[model samples]
Target chain A: MQTVSIDVGDDGTLSAVLRGELDFTQAARIVAAMEAAIDDCRPDSVRVDLAEVTFLDSSGIGALVRAMKAADQVNASFVVERPTLVVFDQLNTAGLVDVFGLRRA
Target chain B: MIPETDSGYLQRLAELEARVDQARLSPEILSERAAGLLAGRIGCRIDEAHAHLRLLAGQQNTSVASVAATVIGALEIRRSTSLRQVRHSVEEALRATDQEPDQPVRVSAPDASYSWLDVVQQMLNALPGKHIVVVPVRGDDGRITDYECVAVSPGMRDLSGRTGPQLIGMAISTAYPDIVGGPVWRAWADSLTDGHPRSVEPFTYVHIDNGDASEHLLTVRVRPVGPGLLNSWVMHDEQTRLAERIDQTERLGNLGYGEWDLITDTTVWSDGLYRIYERDPADGPLPRAESEALGLPEDEPLRRQAAEEFGRGETIDLTTRALINGKVKHLRAVIDTVRDAEGRPRKVYGIIQDVTARETSRRKLAEVERQLHEHQQDLAAEHRLAAQLQHIVLPIPETPVDLPGLRAAVRYLPAEQASRIGGDWFHAALAGDGSVVLAVGDVAGHGVQAAATMAQLRHTMAALTMTTTSQPAELLAHLNRLLLALGVSTAPATAVIVRWEPATHACTWSQAGHPPPLHARAGVAVELPRPAGPLLGGLAHAEYGTNSLDLAAGDILLLYTDGLVEHRERTLSEGTAPVADLMSRVTAERRDYPLDVLLAGLQRANPDDDTCLLAVRRTDCGNGHD
Candidate 1:
């Protein structure tokens, strides 16, 4: 599955929709793609949607942290939304529930 | 047919007698004249005609002078026919002369047949070695005195570099005085006397040229042909040189050749074949049955297939395994046959090549690949076992339990991926001081190493709560120092610890890079503000601050590791908002088991990280009795 699909919103917010297993295998790719999209578009805000993400490991968590750091470097606010219950649980376990701006779908 | 009475007839007869004397003096001249006439009649070269005359004289066992007379006579008798028919008539006359021993034109004189000598010389020139033909010279008593060289092969160079016609008609005794009664001379004499063949044993011949004598080992074979003995000599060194070349070629190609003759019931193997089979040449070629026995039993089918192809008259090329000297070797054999008119094999020939090195390396590569695949499988199995061990060490309680001042429930969720089992752990117990101590922690990363670190942290926490103070801030500070002391090998971990006193309903909590615990009162829930503290193992001498909150009756406090709320696509606050809302709604319901319901309502967010949840609710009854 495609690791992350990036779309530029009308409001200039870059939304990266991550899908499938987002473990160590896809984490690096997801982080690189998100970073590139943020660097290229220089969006005002970055929104990462985890609605389609079936799995996320610690490495995946690290990837999200890196992406957020990328957006912060560009002065763009990073927001994460539309997380499945299991995915939300993982975010919560990593103590990133509030840090990533996760919202239940 | 001339008139005897004519005065010129006497002079003509005298001239004819002189002409006969000249012919006797030079038999070669008479033979050359006859060869020239035959060449003109046959439209061939003079040498070809000369060779033909020599062949005729040798076959007829007669003298060249007599054969020349016969040829001249035949041509004269056919002079009346057309010139084109002259060749045909001459052939017919020769054939008639052959069949009729008493033919009028036939000659049986024992004179020198120079034409026959020329034919033998031509054959010797085509042959590889040195050769010479000599006729015996008889004395008055009819005993052989010496031998005269009539012809010599072109390669028969003496010490002085003389050969062929230069040495012809030279007596052996005059040319090589030492050879008068040598082994070769004896062989020549023996062959001439018995009209049979004889061979001299190898002997050293020393040639003196310009006072420099060089010795050569040579063997000579003498065979009588008509009145002359044909002597063929083999130089030992020359034979060895040719044999050495064959040996080098076979060794370089790792090949050997063998031949089997059915008619002779014998098998011949080249020197290379003996080396390939690791057998001594003195043992001769391996017997058919013994050689077949050397083939590996597993290759019997291949042999059968080859035999079937051979039966169909097809050249059989097959590679099969052979066990030689207790080691297996790959042998590629290409076999064919010499067939007779009936299409049956009269002889079999084959070449065998050793291909063991190539085959062995191919097998070794395949084996290495198989070993690599198996190693990957073993690694996967090890991951599974490590994950299983983590769960065994920290078994979760099936139901909530009543602690010192509140009822608490804990849930431990392992990662969905077996190999991703993280170090998420929880500890809740009543301390010796009677305060309820609760803690939740998650180590970074997953797999066996993370589980080991998690066990160490949890055990240390349990021991500290029992022996040391249960102050939340002090406990986190101690844990941080412990992680720092564990060195760089231990991944940083986040944890939140809480101590609640039932006497005052005062709750104090401290965290190390962990999320703030949720507090719910009268159906309203909010995240408690956290103090500054770095994750454990991040920095040495790091400090943790504690926050105190007074809980009223029916207040719920929830503490969880990040796996319960953290996700790749969401913020911690965003993920926790829903859980806080759920806690408020569930608390408002006034359920008898709010902690159980709240713990059950919360789901782990990430499949790759484990979660630990510890929920505690203050009882409305005094003394914290449920």
Candidate 2:
């Protein structure tokens, strides 16, 4: 299982940083927490930071896609940030790079 | 358990114990008795006999008393005049070793005890090489002239190779004409006159016969005693070279060879053998028991096997480990038995070598190679299991599905990687509401985890469809709630559910973040607008709307996942061309293409993803009746 920490910035940019494996085993738990964080904070913009995540499989990628869909439902702009090399490679393979605005910064 | 002793039994036990104590003889007392008997038989002083016995006891690594006891046993057995026959019989009885403490100390023959002539004969026999006693013959004037051959050992061979009794009564002049006035004759006169030992380092002798001559070099030692002279000789060239060569080979190859006489309990170890075992020559070579004890605990099986082979008189080749000087060494040995006429093992000869470095490194390399092979096998097994799971969870019906209310077909293609058995599945059955529920879903991800989630969702929806209503929009909404309840929010899935009523030929369907269902009519294909809904497990309390229409004959509905039409390098519009073109060709040509053919033609077969395709066609009333 992985833990998700959400920070609501002064500029209303809510960030949910995931730590630990984001594979199928931890996907459901991590995604639900991210959804809850978005609903409660209701920030104008959201940043999903995967800097501490050592692994992320396709199920984890699905969770990211789900988070984006849910963010759209709440009228929030979603930006994915600081994905590790492995997660970035998988995301690039799925051709979701520009769609999620994934960047090193 | 032993019973307690009564007073009478205890008294008797003590008396018997005292009798045993009185019967035991102290070392000095036993030595004195043996020495007195030896001195009386050999006619020597008892103190001289004791000193000789003590010296032999030290060399043989035994107590003086035991050596004395053995001497007494030999003398008592020697009542028979034939020395060789008596010695052999005594050795055989000693091999049984019942209550005998001095059996091992009898390895070497003790000097026979007798008078001067007998002592002289014993000394002659004791010399290691060929030797004979020559008594000088003198004229009335007492000048030494010729020598008489009084006694000879079998080892003393003349130029003609005559030995033993043949040369015993012969004169030296008859055997060797040139031997008179020779240097050997001078030595004989000097030894007899002075009664002291004399030696010539290298004496050259020539043999002349039929005009052929050969010279030989021999070192001679002569000692005068009583009325004759004792002599021994050694060759200067051939014998020394042969022995040195054999010694050279043994040391260089780390090889040792030895012989053990079972009857005498006497073992002989070559110098190489002594070096190989790191043994001190002073302590003497190992006896059978000491050598057997050197094996490590794990070598017990090898020892047992070798013993079994030895009993059969078969040669044994054994390799075993031994702890030597705090290091483990591998010892390889080949043993062969030398049996007597009666088929008993009289002696055993063995060749042994140390092969520790080669064997240890080979074992380690084999261990590493075995581990690498097992690791590769483990990976192959895991892949096979994952591939098996894919087939178990997502089973597609053959050709066309013949359900109660509809004729349908389903196809599922998994990712090419054996370990990536993906989750692409479908379910179709007649519901209790008299309508058929048709569904297709693709769970996100691959492998066991994805397959597990897909099975849960399919089973749950099947249960709901069997007992509950068969409505499209309501079913999608319920499934969305089910996903949230199951806590599968991380793995979103796309699905389309259809409810077909056979009574009115009406069909209604809805989607959950899935592509729109395709409707084909009379050679034309059009994508139906998807109902308003989000992907499952993403949004809570998400809404879904459905569109219903009455279907006539010759109409087809196709539902599929994104894998059936999407490619990474192309736009969505362009990727849809294959499906559209295949659909138009199938319907327009009236080619009577099976639903499987249409699906195979449309699917792009991506190696990185899974695909599911389901198709249903409205049948004519007459065809349905058939």
Candidate 3:
């Protein structure tokens, strides 16, 4: 389901738009795409957009954490944006909202 | 048109006349003349007359030319004026030809001996298999020098590719000099000399082509016919190879063949047939009645159909079951009959194929399919039972109930699919300390196990609230510890628990990996800030904290499981936005019995998970000291 699409901004920020059900099935693919984008762009900042994500299970949460870690390893600032209420609730339940820098946009 | 008086022309005429006289005595010319004369006398075709002469020679076991000579001699005697004399002379000629081995009988018609070769050639032309007639050419010392081929079967060809008329007059010693002293040549000479049949055992005959030699194993049989020997050659390896091929095919195909001669009442079964029936070859073929009795009773109709088709002179190809040695086997029989000239069955031939392996596997696959269907049915039944148990364990109240300082209404929505009944549940009741205890919990997973865990957790919370302190944080901690102590079989769960004190107008709540409750007031709704607490059964020493919020009359608080705001097609916030907006609108409307209305208005975002919702509203009737 078109798991991730990446765009590099002029300010050295890499924005990756994630789509479809972000469960165990798409978790590995999402992480790999994010890592590849981070390695290729070496951006100053990274933003993962969960605006189109329809579902998030525990595995999806793990993938987001892994992506954030990948960004950290590259000395980049990572932010998660535009999570639906259900996804936000899930992040909050896992106590990852603050850790992922989840914010409304 | 030379002048008749020319000496050269006269000498040419005398030479031609002598040549004609010599040709008349030749065997071919003599046989032709005799056949012509016989045809004219009998008023029949010359070919029929020649055939008749050959047939008579065969009956008498003599040469056609000898028979023709006897006929000519009788006719010449008849020309001398007496039919009785002709008959006597014919009888005498036959007797002398039979008795005299070395004597000259009737001037020893030496040329007449070879006249039948053409008739023999005609016979060979009409034959089906490989055959050739070769006449012995005598040397000056009277010993057989060599044999010259006079007739060849139409289908017979030498290694040189010469066949039929091309092989005529070819000396065997020149064409196949390798066999001049071989077993076949010796057999031919011996058969000619003794006028008896002889056969040579299989021997290798090698032919050289362009200095490359190829070897063939052949058998030769010769029978003396007139002044020649009729030789039949067989490729010894081909016959043996053909029989082996048939045997191998039968074995590999799991098939057997049987033939029954109706006229003789004799039955013959191939070796494969004996193997198929698992009978010793020494036992002979099974009797027809016994073999028929082996057919399973269930296949009687198929047998009847086959019999009917057979009676109509139709070939029967049928598959039926047989019980042999107590094991059922599938047999496919293809039966046909050899019919007589009048269309009556003279012989019956049948090929029986053992197809038991194929049939057995087919039946097994069908059985497996039936079993899979029944397994799915059992799973469906289990789902129904699990759903029923879920309803009985966590029954939702139809109307809101009055808690210490609030009106609480609970609604339970099952998953859209019947099999997805889950562990979502809610509890809203008064504790022993005059405080109201409320809780909404969701056990991970579905089916009966989830329902059972939900029941256990609900009962444990109820018991804890009645006997222990009415504190949200303490109660959550206790529930978490209880989940951990219940062992790995108990799935991890999320729950939000709250204790409401009517005297203080204080609502203290805590959650374990659960969403904070939504608080709605005058035209606004917001999710309460959640305290630091991990989900139940996550750690050995997990701590929970409480969040307290002062409530006034007409304030509505909604607590629900993730199913209410979880969907596969959208993010969590998207799913919850509408619910939050609805709560704000409901509070703004200031409708009476807003708790009931809010619960009724809410819809689950994900139909694949069960949703449990608890809505409570602060009422003016409660003994609030705010």
Q: Best DockQ goes to which candidate?
A: 3
Isolated chain A TM-score, each model? 0.93, 0.89, 0.93
lDDT of each: 0.76, 0.71, 0.77
Q: lDDT tens string, model 3, A1-105?
A: 578999999999999999988864576688788888898889999998999986786446656766776787688988889987767768778655655686532
Better of 1 and 2 by TM-score: 1
Please tell me the TM-score of chain A for candidate 1: 0.93
In terms of TM-score, which candidate is strongest?
3
- Kindly give the stretch of ten consecutive residues in candidate 3 chain B with the minimal lDDT sum: B15-24
Q: What is every candidate's alpha-carbon RMSD to the true fold?
A: 22.7, 18.6, 19.6
Query: How close is every model to the real structure, measured as TM-score?
Result: 0.47, 0.43, 0.60
Quantify how close model 1 is to the true structure by its C-alpha RMSD in Å. Answer: 22.7
Candidate 3 or 1, higher TM-score: 3
From the highest TM-score down, the ranking of the candidates is 3, 1, 2
Q: Tell me how much of the true interface, by contacts, candidate 2 captures.
A: 0.27
- Extract clashing residue pairs from model 3: A54-B570, A84-B572, A84-B573, A84-B574, A85-B572, A85-B573, A85-B574, A86-B572, A86-B573, A87-B572
Per-residue alpha-carbon lDDT of model 1 for B1-626, expressed as tens digits? Answer: 12336555345334323322111225677688788767655434577677778877897787776577667655544455576576675675576457664533212222437435655664565456788888989999999899899888876787678877688989988776667888888888778777779888789887777778888788888888767888887888778998898888889988899998655557999887887889999999999889999999999999988877776667889999988888898999999876432233556899998888889999999999999899777767767766776667677888877775577788887778766777888888887687888988887777777788888888889888888988987887788788867864456678899888877777888887788899987688999988766566655566777888877777888988877777667766777888988888887877454576668878887566788898887876644543
Worst ten in a row by lDDT for model 2 chain B: B105-114
Ranking by lDDT: 3, 1, 2
Classified by CAPRI criteria, candidate 2 counts as: incorrect
Docking class of 1: incorrect
TM-score (0 to 1) of chain B, per candidate? 0.50, 0.43, 0.65
